[model samples]
Each structure stands twice: as structure tokens, then as C-alpha cells.
Target chain A: MKQSTKYMMSDGLAFSEKRDLKRLQKKSKEGWHLFSFLPMGYNLQKGEPKELQYSVDYRHLQDGEDQEYFELFEMAGWNHVCSEVGIHFFVAPMGTQPIYTDVESQIDKVQRLSKNVYMTAVFFVLMTVVSYFVSELTTGIVSSIFHYILLASEVFTIPCLMMVASLLYRKWVKKS
Target chain B: MKSLEQLTDSVFYIMAALVQPKHGYAVMALVEKETGGEFTIGPATLYTIIKKLLNENLIFLHDESNPRRKVYALTEKGHHILVKDIERRKTMLSLAERELRGGNAE
Candidate 1:
């Protein structure tokens, strides 16, 4: 047992509040809520781990096959992280770890990507309008057909420009 | 002295414990004992440190211990790091003393 020490951005619950899987299983025999954090770890080895490695089924988590668990993991941080999960779960806070996951930032990044597209659309609209009016004024000519043609041209060019912009944006904002 | 950042502190502490050839459990006990019940590392924390140390070859798992238990022994690089860290601390203490005494001299 140790005195109160500040845990750095990590689970402090392991002190008194947590139990190892072995202990948890033992407690389950006596009927204590066997809360688990991370998976049971095996002793690691050198040169490509052979057996006794934790497998993460990325497909199940990524795909909507495990929808309920996915939502819970999303709203909270982890899946299979037991608390008062069976019946008294109604009273306890629905979420577990309050810490932000990479997914949270990933969602934000997606929003930013959409925002980039919207901004690009607005910019192209403004640019097209400016170009049409300026070209008309510069040559002192009035052609509604040309205005329509210019707008149609933008339909193709704008998408191409947006694609180029997206590539550039991705390069600039590649997740470090 | 500058307070060592959390990451650096953990690294330093784990490296310090690996000065002798000791297994995972033994290192944990030694660190806990050294800190006088001030600290107890979680399994995950210890695992990460062990992984990093092993990857860097600053510490290697010795085969002398029970095959089940991962015993660690420090390398030449690890000794250099420990020595460098001690020297830096000494320099920092002297600088601190000078600054503290210098303030009163004026």
C-alpha cells in the first residue's frame, strides 16, 4: 500500500478502487463487482510475440456490428469496462472515463473537413460572382448567356479546385 | 531544481530501479520501498516503461530469473544516463545554493 500520490493523466483507481483480473475472479466467487480496466496482459517477449497476445477486433468495433458496445465506448472511453453495469447502472453515471479519446478529436477533425468544404464553396461562389461582374465591367459588354456559361464552367472547375484544396489540406493537417 | 516532467520522472525512476539485475515484481517492490510507500506503479505504467526500456536496449531482460518473470539488467547506455542525470542534479543544487546565498550577499 502507498500513500496518496498524484497520478498523472492515468488511472488512479488502481490504488484501492481497482482489482486485478485474478483478484476480480476471486472476488466474483464472493460476489464483489469485478470491474476491469484494460485487458489481462501476458508477459511480453522479444522478436514477434507468438502466443498470449491480446487481440483487438477492430472490425467489430469499427463496423456497426457491435452497435451498443460501440456507442457506450464512444460516449465513454472503453468497452467491457465494468462498473455497476447490471441493474444499479441506472443510478450510476452512464459514462466511465471522462478523458477524451482519439475518436473525439477524430470527430472534430471530420467537422473541420466539412467546414473546409463549405468555406471552399462560399469562396468559389464569391470568386465566380466577382469575376463575372469584373469581366463584364472591364469590356463594357452585357451577355446573360456568358454569365450562365461561366456559372456552368464553375460546376466542373470548382469541384476540381475543391479536390486540390482537400489534398493540400490533408497534407497540412496530417495527424502527428 | 526544475521539477522533472511526469514522463521524465517515471523514466528516471524506472531506470534507477534497473541499476541492479531485478525482475518486474522485485523492481516494483524496490521502487515502492525506496519511495517509502510514497508511490506504487500500476501494471500498465510499469509495462509501458519496460517496453520502452527494452526497445531502447537501455535495459535487457536477463534469463537468469524464473523464465516466467521478466528480469531486467541495465546496459552501458543506461549507466551513462543515470550518471548524467545525477551530475545534472548536483549542478542544479549548487546553482540553487549560489542563487539563494547571492540574493542575501547584496
Candidate 2:
């Protein structure tokens, strides 16, 4: 058997983490379990139908920390699914306590995610500005190169900015 | 994460449990058991708080021979902070109780 597989588009976690997790839960019930994360979406493999709840946590693990980190979640009944970048995904039976139980820690999770997003956004914004200035100051093939750079940077900068804005808004909402 | 100015319920429970030098999972189980399942700390939350406490010098690693189950215990500073938080909570409880008992009926 070639193994059944499919892809599902994500709505961008910074905008819709809750919606995405809920969708994963629904897919698990239909026997399509998430196999791994793909850029902009998920790669799912067919499996035994299950009633599971999914959650995402953001943290940078240091050397020798991953073992204890995963163990803690396992002991709490959450089975580790996969991790991409600093985002980790876990699943457990429905009604299991959520991974984040307090508002302070929940806010901290958002801040860690925001920190990563903010750095990327800053880089893209700088690229966009630098390329725009160089494209205007130079001419010929060199100008075209910077012009392309400006366009590419803008493309990335817009979404990065939106993600940062959304994350900051979430942090503010949680604080209030 | 910044040092906690006040212990949140989750942190309070974890701190109280760590007074006995327990591992991460042990802390979670103790909190759930002591609270009669009414209060519980999820694993991630417990881990985050434990790290914060460690960073703030409120807790220390009691044993790490078992890397997967490092035990933690409260530091002297941690005990002092915990005691202060308990006193603060006690004051709040007393105020609520007095009002509920019509100490200042109006």
C-alpha cells in the first residue's frame, strides 16, 4: 500500500492557531492524522479514527532539556506529536487539561512566539527599505536587482507585519 | 519570563508541592491530589513555572542523576516568598469572610 496522504492549508497560525488545532482534531476523528508540518499547511496520513484534542506550545529547548520537557507532557497524558521550529504539537483524549493552565504562563507563551516573529518582521522591513532606496539611487541591471529585492521583501514584510500585529493584539487582549 | 511579583495559583501550588523536593510529574500529581481534582496544573504550565522559579532562584535542582526526572525543591528565598504570598491570601480570605458574615452589614 502506498499509504494514503493529503495536505491541508493552514490559515496562518499567528492568525488562527485555535482554528487550526480544532481542524486537526476534526481530521483525527475522520482518521486523517497529522503526520508533520509543511510550509503553509500540514501533511496528514490516514490512521485509526480517534477522538483527540490538539494543542500547540512555543518554547526554545536547551541542550538536555528536551527529554524532561517531553516527559512532563507525557506524564500529563499528552502524547507528543511533532515539533517545527519552536512550536510543539501534542494530542490527548478529549477533556484532558489544557497545556496552559494559567494566564501568566499563557501570556509568556505568546511572548516567546512574538519574539521570533518580530525578529523576522524586522529583517524583512529593513530589506524592503534598503532595497527601495538602492533601487531608486541606482540604475540599469543593478537597479532592477534591487527593485526585485524590494518587491520580494515587501511580499514577506506584509505578512510578517500582520503576524506581529496579531500577536501583539493577542498579548494585549490577554493582559487586559 | 520576568520573576513573578506574586505567585499565581498554579505557581503557588507548584511551590507548595516542591517544598518536599518532587519531580515535575510528582508536582502535578500532588497538586491534583491535594486539591481533590478541583485544581490542576497542566504539564506545560508546570514546566514553565518550574523554569521561571529556577531562574528567579526560588527553586533549586534537588537531584538530576535521572535527567528525565530532575527533582526540585524550594530555595530559602522561595520559602520566604511563598510564606508572604500565603499571608497575603489569608488576609484576603479573612476580609471576604468578615463581609460575608455581616461584620459591616449595611
Candidate 3:
């Protein structure tokens, strides 16, 4: 099969899922359909143009219930697409019923996604601190190759913290 | 004896739609028809609500024979909550009407 793939970066956070959905829909209209989801992005295959409505659900599939969950959504008029970790993607024709029907459920989905991201951010921060202490104890306070690696890790931690902070602000500070 | 705290429009309509056993797409169709195009329940919302309702025993799977399309029906508990909610709304509407008439008399 002749196929072309497009890699687009995405924030694996709940708040940004809607943006990703919109992007997928737009790409689909241009004959680029989503083939699979990749880490931090999506892989789309070039194909006949489609006007498909895209939505992503953030839910952890339980043991032995994966088929049931997909069947339920499929029965609801959504065609299941690829899923990555806790994120499930689906598409239906334009005007197909939306997956979320109420504000409470929608908020619940947001909270779940935020919780996952928040926990990951916390874990990263703890790892960075612990590694810094261990490196200091073994390699002395003097700068070395290990010190440079630690510096790079600390820089990466900034974005994780920022992502958590933004999610918190939206969850609590923003009324909506 | 489940007391609902302000059912969202979608939840209310969905429950009402499933007074009879219906599949997922049927519920969506009924909701849209009943609302007269005023509202439509999204698939994501419907899926989540159905799962929650099933967990709370407000709704149950009516049939599992159809692998792709599972049918659902309201449980007894769901009926009780819906009727009570209707009665509550009736009371509120009657009281509002009485207040409006009293002001008119003045």
C-alpha cells in the first residue's frame, strides 16, 4: 500500500485534546486521515478526503472490558480509531452525536486527564531532585559530564511543571 | 431511592428516551426528536453517561446478544428518580404560576 505519513506534535494533556481533534478533522478534509497515534503526535495517512468528526475520550480501559467499551461507543455511532495509553480516538460523520452529553461528565474527563499529567509531573520533579543529590554525593560539587546531563534534565522539567500549573489554573481559577 | 441533584438536560432526556429498551443510536434519535432540534446529545457524552448510569444502577443492559449494538433500558430506580424529578418540576411551575397570577390581581 502506498502511504504517506505526517507527524504532528501534541501535548498529551486533556485540555489540548480538543485542539488535536480539530486538527485531525481539518487534516481529514484534506485527504489526510489519521492512521495511528504516536508519542506526542499523530500519524496520518494520505487518502481520499473525508469530512469526519473527530473526538477523543480520556478513560482508562479496565481489564476484560476493552471490547465492551469499544462496542458501546461503536453502538453510539462513533467508529473507534487508534488509542494511545488512556486516550481513545473516534470519528463519525459530521453532526454525529457528541460523546460527552453533560458538563459534569465533561469536567470529570478533564479532571482525570489532569490527574494523570499532574502525577507524572510530580514524579519527574522527584526524580530530578533525587538524581541531583545522588550525583552531587558521588561526583562532588564540581561540574562534570554528569552535571551537564543533570542540567539538561532540569531544563526539561520546566515544561512539565508549566503544563501542570496551567491545568490547575484552568481547573480552579477558570470558572468554566 | 437515588436522589438526583439537578439532572443535566441530556441525562434527563436520555432517561426519558429509554422508558423502553433502546440501543445507543436509538437513544440519540429519540432525544433529538423529543427536543425538536433544540438539543442533541453528543456520542461522547452519551457513552459516558450510560456507563455512569449503569454503574449507579439507574440503567441496565437490556440485551447483550447484539454484540455491536447493546440495548439498554431504565432500571426501576431510574423510573423512580425520573418521576420524582417531574413532580418537583410541576410543583415549581405551579408555584411560579400562582405568583404571577397574584401579581396580576394586584
DockQ (Cα-based) per candidate? 0.01, 0.80, 0.46
Q: Write the per-residue lDDT of candidate 1 for residues B1-106, one digit (tens) a residue.
A: 0112222555677788888887665665677689996765533245445655777777886753344355688899877877788787788799899888874555
Residue range B3-102, candidate 3, lDDT tens digits: 1466666778888888899977788778778779689877667777778788888899999786556789999999998898788788889989988888
The digit string of per-residue lDDT tens for model 3 on A120-168 reads 8877787678667767777655536557667777886888888887777
**TM-scores for chain A, candidates in order?**
0.25, 0.96, 0.84
The whole-model lDDT of each prediction reads: 0.46, 0.92, 0.77
Ranking by lDDT: 2, 3, 1
RMSD in Å for model 3: 3.9
Write the candidate numbers in order of decreasing DockQ.
Answer: 2, 3, 1
Candidate 3 scores a chain A TM-score of: 0.84
Worst 10 residues of 1 chain A by lDDT: A51-60
lDDT of 2 by residue, A24-90 (tens): 9999999999879965999898989999999999999998999999999999999999988888999
Q: Each candidate's interface RMSD, rounded to one decimal?
A: 12.8, 1.1, 3.1
Best by lDDT: 2
